[model samples]
Target: MTDIKATVFIPTYYGEDNLDELFTALSTQKVGFEYEILVIDTSSKDRTPEIIKSWEPKFKHFRYETITKPEFSHGRVRQQAAEKARGEYVVYLTQDATPAHDRWLYEIIQPLERFPQVVGVMGKQDPRTTALPLLKEEIIRTFKQFGPDFGTTLFYEDDFIDSQQLFDLVTFYSDVNSAARKSVLLGDVPYQDIPYAEDQKFGEDLIRHGYMKAYAPRANVWHTNEIKLRDYKKRMFDEIVGVRRVGKTMDPISILFVIKQVIRAVTLGSLFILKDHQYTWKRKLYWLALNPLFVIEKWKGVRAAIAVDLDDEQTIVKQSLESNEAIAHGKQ
Candidate 1:
């Protein structure tokens, strides 16, 4: 058997609709070395299993396992996948994050293959065309901070003065499109059993332990969640709460702060919408007018997240979209 160079690990729940495109893209990857696809399904009631079965014959090695929804944990399942991987590296992708090009797989694992010191590599994200203007803009802005879209940037522990400095610059590591060394994952920097921001925490852990993390901008994925207007606040709240669990916190909310945030969000969002060429003038005008409402809801969510006590499960359950989903369907 050809030795597997990497394992592409995806943890899915009700991802039947996305599997076909993801697998089709994977099949076309230009990776010169051998790799395997491993999927762990959280007992999805949809056609997820059937989809996986259909794709089994397309790859030399394909593995799938099913676990009850209640048994799924973002960090625990990923750590288990790393342990089970037959490759030197493990590349992670959420079901909806499809590779943007044939070179994605090769590029993402390139750093791990070349730089023995790089414990992890994060790929760039290009928001799907269906993503909202604000969401697309956020994705672009976030990735731009790392470096040029076609360049490679590396982060090292020796460059930062303190953990705060490290967190400020490099804590954005995302498993949505990322690769890491299996040995490091299994050894000093296993994913923690946390509900949110496990990827960021893992990156932080690796850097703190004197290891390096790389950002490969050429390795990109089309990823986004189409959040409804009504659900926007809940999503933001869930995100803030999740980051808090991973040791990142927001300042306490005040009326003055809320006012300032609202003004900032509206002004910046309006300008972004007006400047974006993707939308038509009519659509831009519409979004420009509606931007204030979304911005208001966003600040409301931020305020609620900052004010709520994390230990209060009841409050968290009420405010968090993820908590509600987990409670309702036993999946995160």
Candidate 2:
């Protein structure tokens, strides 16, 4: 076998729907480096395992293992896979997120190769066509988070205003589509034992350790899911848990700042929809009505998260906790 330059680590559960297209896209990557894929699956009852076996003949370097659901921790599982990887660079991707194009793998790993100081890099996300209007807007906003400078943008601890700002920046990155140097990821800053947002925790370690991180927009991936109010709230709770587990705290003062942001975002988005020539007034009105709901949902999420952080059990309100647990276990 050729020497592996990069390893793509994916954690999956009931991902039968996207497996075929995902493997096909991975096979088409236009790169000079030899790459391998390592998948750690939570024992799925569906045809997910069968499909993976079927694709083995097609991908010479593909390998996977099965683990029970109880054994799964977002960070720990991926870390387990990374420990087994032999590549110099480790790339993380969710099973459902397909590469936007063949160049995605090539583009994402380029930053790590170009800058020795850049320990990690993240790519842009494009929502699926089946996504709801609210989700589509969110996907656009996430893609635009890096700004116009598509080129490599480095982030350091000093760039932030305060510890909270630094924590927010570090913990906001998603591992859904990202890459890191193997040495740094395994040696100096290994993945933690967080239940969610382990990617952000890794980012925290990077900045604290004085290593740089980069945003590489040229690398694109398709990733999104339509979410109801409860789902959003549940995610917020998990996000808070992740942040606290990594020794970061959200400031009580930032609550006001977040509220201000919500108003500004709602107002600007509503005005844009109203002024756009392509949208009919009825459509404009509908969006205006829905946009505030989105803002309110986010505000609710933050508040619930704060409550979880402050509570003795480190849990959200009891009523909401039951709902979030159901959603987490696929009971809903």
Candidate 3:
């Protein structure tokens, strides 16, 4: 009879294997407030539908719907789900990300309620048991790159002195394990219709609106995608394009950037192998040998994505934010 305090929105495709654990974890969350799970499935071919149906009786406020892949737009579909959500906060999670603890739901939404200035909060991601050794090390390195206090860090618009730092923070926001105010997401700062990185685009808008984005170390999830060399390269390309689209800067691809990043990767990989006591020398050497190939693949991907002509931008990429906003305002 009462509206929920939070809505966990998940857009799932072929996620049958993880659905059971994910729902079980959600059912046992130890939050003080009431919450519901809303799943928008893109017609998964596996047993995902049956798995979801089996759990419906267990969850008091579970809801589900199926949509065709052709009808899906990452930002648009998620926005549609938010529009239908009846909660104070909208929490987004990938189907594979299981709650690290029962306290995850409570901790993830704490920052949003604690500070009016904060519009978004992202949770930490721990590697799953199946994560490769190299991938685990990569995840740890990424967290450290955020800094010593990355666990509970907050990014404010005024704190950034340079455009690059601001861009870095904007693009770093991830929807994998994040929460946002329902009012903010649906009313003032909704996600833009970007093809690849709508989370980053939404984050850019949040920062521009003078809002804060938080990193909740206490709210962590077990999530990882074991990407191979080729997939990693493709991911890098998409990321580079996403950055360019949101930044609206047509700065040409830099040869210096490629060189610098490759060198840095080599240096860091070597240092990590030399210092880490967890792995045997044979394993370290194997990773070191693969590191160069990984670096080269990523560099080539970045270069390729950047070298595309702007005249073909519209055909290759989705409609721009300006176009989306115009459509929202009935101006197109």
**Candidate whose lDDT is highest:** 1
Candidate numbers, best lDDT first, in rank order: 1, 3, 2
In model 1, which runs have C-alpha deviations exceeding 4 angstroms?
159-166, 330-332
The pairs that clash in candidate 3 are none
lDDT for every model? Answer: 0.86, 0.75, 0.77
**Best-first order by TM-score:** 1, 2, 3
Give the winner by lDDT: 2 or 3.
3
RMSD of 2: 3.9
Question: Highest TM-score: which candidate?
Answer: 1
Worst 10 residues of 3 by lDDT: 317-326
Cα lDDT tens digits, model 1, 1-332, are: 78999999999887887889999999999877999999999888779889998999999989999998667778889999999999999999999999999999999998888888999999999988656766788899899999897679998766445667556577568999999999989899999987777887898899888888999999999999866778789888987887788888567777887687667657887787777777888888777776667767777887888788889999888988766766677454
- RMSD of every candidate to native, in Å, equals 2.1, 3.9, 6.1
Candidate 2: tens digits of C-alpha lDDT, residues 1-332: 67999999888777898988888999899999888989888887788999888887887698889987668888898788778888998899998889999999999998888888888888888877554445666678765866553576777677544666545655457788999888876789898876666887888788779887888778888887546655665565666655666676664436677677567757776665666565667777776777667666666766666655345453443435434554565744
Clashes of 1: 0
TM-score of 3: 0.82
TM-score for each model? 0.92, 0.82, 0.82
Give residue 164's error in model 1 in angstroms. 2.3
lDDT of candidate 3 over 43-92, digit per residue (tens): 77779899999998998898999987657767887788789898899999
Candidate 2 residues lying further than 4 Å off, grouped into runs, are 142-149, 159-163, 170-172, 252-291, 309-332
